[model samples]
Target: MLDLFGDEDTLALAESHRTLPGRFGAGTRDRAGVLSALSALSQQAGGAEFGIVLGSGFEGAPDLIAEIGARHRLLGAAPETVAALNDPFRLAALCARLAIPHPAITAGPVADRDAWLVKRIGGCGGSHIRASATGSTPPGHYLQARMPGRAFALNFLSDGRRIEPLALTEQWQAPSPLRPFRYAGALARGRDEAEPIPPAIEARIAEAALRLARETGLTGLASADCLVEGERWWLLEINPRPGATLDVLDRRPTPLLLQHIEASLGRMPAIEASPTDATGAEICYAARTCPAMPPLDWPDHVHDRPRVGSPVARDAPLCTVTASGPEAVTVKEELRSRTAQVRTLLEETENSHEFQHERPEPQRPGGTAGREPRR
Candidate 1:
């Protein structure tokens, strides 16, 4: 078993092996490296149950699956349908095929430098994505006219035929006139803060997603990233796997991860809305500068947290702090206050001597017993 991103517990569930390089970044060379790694891992883990690949992690693994070629040819309908549903040269091609209204797009790369976006033809998580300045375009990529307006991501789950929307989150990117827009975090907008999705646009997105599933024979969880300008909804990209909001899905009574696993095993459960409807604004607060990893000396109260020596990076996920109340503003304020406390605690831990010399425990299966954070 080759579990690329597996933690100790996850590894215990399968036969673990080494990881392939370039699982995170985007570039022709890196993408190629990832593909090669996947292929090697697949060959190594022959006859294992279905392989679940994340992001560029899928590169070559599919080839290793015994019947994957036939399965993809027979079951992978959405990818092919999306490819043929629209002409790469025209924006209207997608709109016509999906029966949705969108900002007009040219079929090919825009000749004018300021009017086009050169984007990857695959999934979207802010990877391998870029906007073109007319003449500066990458080869072998899809080009479409850029749509103007704020961006919104609607996260949902599907059971082949039935689709259940979880939440519509507003994405925030740092205001950088010089740098390409990068996804920072998501905000759970309340009634006042929530941006309303018109029925027409919602219907269009849902229909397109369903049609995609039907075409591709997708049977489990997936997400669609779309842009909303005025009343128009423009399809951005579709992810065949879980999205960044997987943690949000974890808050559900039956975690989306479990659901996906079950679906993959051919046990499709009845899809339902998340058990918890508590909603306010949820935003990912991050450091504008590098924040050092804090030591683990939590009080005896908090439990089941990461160890003191866990390696955390700038963009690597730390922990998600959520707040909810009867109203949106109150929840937003609560989350903000809570996040500040977390940051302060982390900073204090960094400055403390305990963090500098604490030795992490040996790797153990479900070894989180005493190491959990005491909040």
Candidate 2:
């Protein structure tokens, strides 16, 4: 298999991995580089047939997908379907038509900046979201009134004709000063086990997802993020591609990626949610800048390892940690413990390296260089 190898985690997953022409970030900035990389890889494929299955970053940019699909097959939603699902106004209208609760959104103006959030179009992760009061909205962004509720996502697989519910994930935030709603991690109960949400709410969300998929002809794995308060809920947005929960949900005997390809081809697999351990995954961020990554043993639960000597900036993602067990509460506790362990390990390693590299004072002309300064 071939992949863009955007991070170290993906670097080892594919037989042949290539980097894009430039750094990849949220929004529409990296489309050209993606096209260039795909062209190069396609040429080297020696006329072999291959299809594209995307993750989080590309769902907001259907034209880019169209450009990529022009040369190769796309094993996901069509460009029109993507445009329909991703457009904020269109989605709001669709929700209204379908009698689904949706937050008020507008691209034109915000009467109360404090009441709304500025979100970049096609932006995944909480980094791209900020209060409208923070700054003016840039191009390819919109304003949505902040909803009051806890965050949740329903992950599902679709085949254009039908859908299968995968898992219900409860998401949380890791707030920084600037990024108060930054995505921290998500937790889900064991497959086939009782989800954290009420059965009524789960049914409602599943129904909404199925209806939205039919309306947009959505195919492959996707996630629908929402906010729920008591029995009331609002659909936030649809990530029309594989989402972050893939780590926790893709544990079946048949790999989900292969199933994704089949679903995209209009064939739905008979995927029964088997009973499995509850899983939790979180993204750990660096607390300080590391000029060079120091060598240290990463725990078994830690993943997305950066190469030694790679510079890690303060507040940047350091790595991901995952945990799984028979119960959700214990799994979450384990995730927290593992996250702390990884952070502490990095801090100690860096400190030890600094001490090892410390330079001692040399003897001065007066032979008092090693002495402490006298008050």
Candidate 3:
């Protein structure tokens, strides 16, 4: 899996960002390379226990995953199921079949582009999504009618028949001229065991997730992207794997891979609510082209340290800042403040440099091992 973290000792590791010097992923474009690299690496590191694919790029191309699965055991959804969910029209159809609330989805552009968004199939982190304008129907894309409300994500553990809700998180996107709709991060507002569950919304979301999981055979750590407006809840998509915000929502001693493996094996480990207050993670992006990665005196709160001298492009995320507190509002404010501080530090470092003569590299590696700094 190409992500932020490497595989545990129990499993052979083959992921992007193999070391601290790795760059971020460029979606499915890196699959071929990751596939080749993992092939040799998997052989060397004592055959993999199972493959866990990551990101929207992986979601976009299910066939590639299927092929990889042939060589390595994969612990997530079947390729066919991924294909069904990857298609927006099919996902909406499934929602209707399962009686789940969903926004009106169109196979083509809607009349009012302002109220619609053109989204690519299987795109993650809202990167391949854009406001609909032209009536043109791009291949592998669909128009989703915008709904009124703030976005919320439900991170849950599923045994393919029953769902154990983990945490309910709020989604944020940091938009820029270069990278509009880039995923910012998430805040864990509610947990199933400890944190307070919002009145009716929690039950509705859990019911939807349970039904979908049973129907699709989704297991392990997966997330449901949803929108809540008034007393109603609408599910946007279901990512059938351990996703971003796994850290923010779950600060418990149990590691994420353990939870995922247990659920995949049909085990429901006892989960307790967060004992602390609301906690969140936010990514600070590069507002302008920078010469080199700044020297950040990272406290325990900061994560995903950039490789020294790695050039960051305009709108690309620099690093993630984290904060936890008793109140939700306080945590949110702290994350915002930290984000600004990091951005300021990067700017100051760039301006003071005699100029390192660095530019953002175009060739991004495919073998990633870190969680995306995504909402």
Candidate 4:
């Protein structure tokens, strides 16, 4: 249960934790810091053995994966698999070979930049996706033509030989002035999901994912992002690791983590039908900067709590709000309401002069705020 942390709650679910030198973000700024952190964490492990199961943050950083794998066993996809899956050109070629519909992608200039999106080669989350018209494509980025359809993700477990579909989630974006395609949250498809995906369509998406996994030797928990309009669909990308929907889809009697471990060992677990309760999870971003976070009673539904006196930057994730109900619409509505309530709580905390005076001393810099608790 040894894991890494960066200004996030070290007291998070993991039994043991180590700290990274810098804050969390994309690119080279954090690379040396992560390797240094892993070095320290590995020594702390002593002679103990463990395996790595990656999450969203490491999708684009295969070098880090290889570095970690060199020291410890890997419980997920290999670094080469991750590198290939994260390449847009490689993905498009695979889709073409498999006859899966994929939007046209190119590194060269496009006639109508507005009609295309510039995406980083290994970007995770949607923050790296922007309209081509916004600016010239940066190094390590490519352009993909915009396609019509709603966003959906298919979650599955693979054993390098076969795959077992886990769950499908409908996704939405929380666009900001600069990040037009920022990922907001996801809602698991259930009996009450609005205009539920047809069985045939689900099967088609599942088959495509299976084919992609088999071809790439993908192992462990992974998710496939796609777009669907009516029966027509397009495979967007494969996040070769466990993704955000885990909050909504990980309630089965058998923990998906164990299943991931087993699958990585070439033993695929038999997955039962997904829970029928429509569960949703959304991020509550801070609207304004808070010089210091006030200690308050965080409701059970509100998770990823920051430490007292921690600085909360505007537009940074404050916490995650989750809700579940018999119907998807009502569950989503509840999520919105809860998100508002959490924001109001933060406002009230900021304005409380008495509480301000009584605010507890800040603890260590690391506390789980925006990043996932490493495992």
Maximum-lDDT candidate: 4
Clashes of 2: 0
> Which stretches of candidate 2 lie above 4 Å from their native place?
1-6, 21-24, 134-136, 191-193, 353-375
| Winner of 2 and 3 under TM-score | 2
What is the TM-score of each predicted model, taking all chains together? 0.66, 0.89, 0.85, 0.91
Q: In candidate 1, where is summed lDDT lowest over 10 consecutive residues?
A: 366-375
Clashing pairs in 2: none
TM-score of predicted structure 2 = 0.89
Candidate 2 lDDT by residue in tens digits, 232-318: 999998888876677777778888888888889999987865548898898887787765566668887787666555555666667
> How does model 4 fare in lDDT?
0.77
Q: How does residue 87 of candidate 1 score in lDDT? A: 32
**What clash count goes with each model?**
11, 0, 15, 6
Residue-wise C-alpha lDDT for candidate 3, range 81-149, written one tens digit per residue: 677766788789899998899988887746677888888777787766788878545887788888877
- Per-model root-mean-square deviation over C-alphas: 7.2, 9.1, 4.5, 3.0
Error at 370, model 4, angstroms: 7.8
List the candidates ranked by lDDT, beginning with the highest.
4, 2, 3, 1
**Which residues of candidate 3, in runs, are more than 4 Å off?**
1-27, 48-56, 178-180, 190-198, 351-375
The 10-residue segment of model 4 with minimum total lDDT is 366-375
Angstrom error of the Cα, residue 75, model 3: value is: 2.0
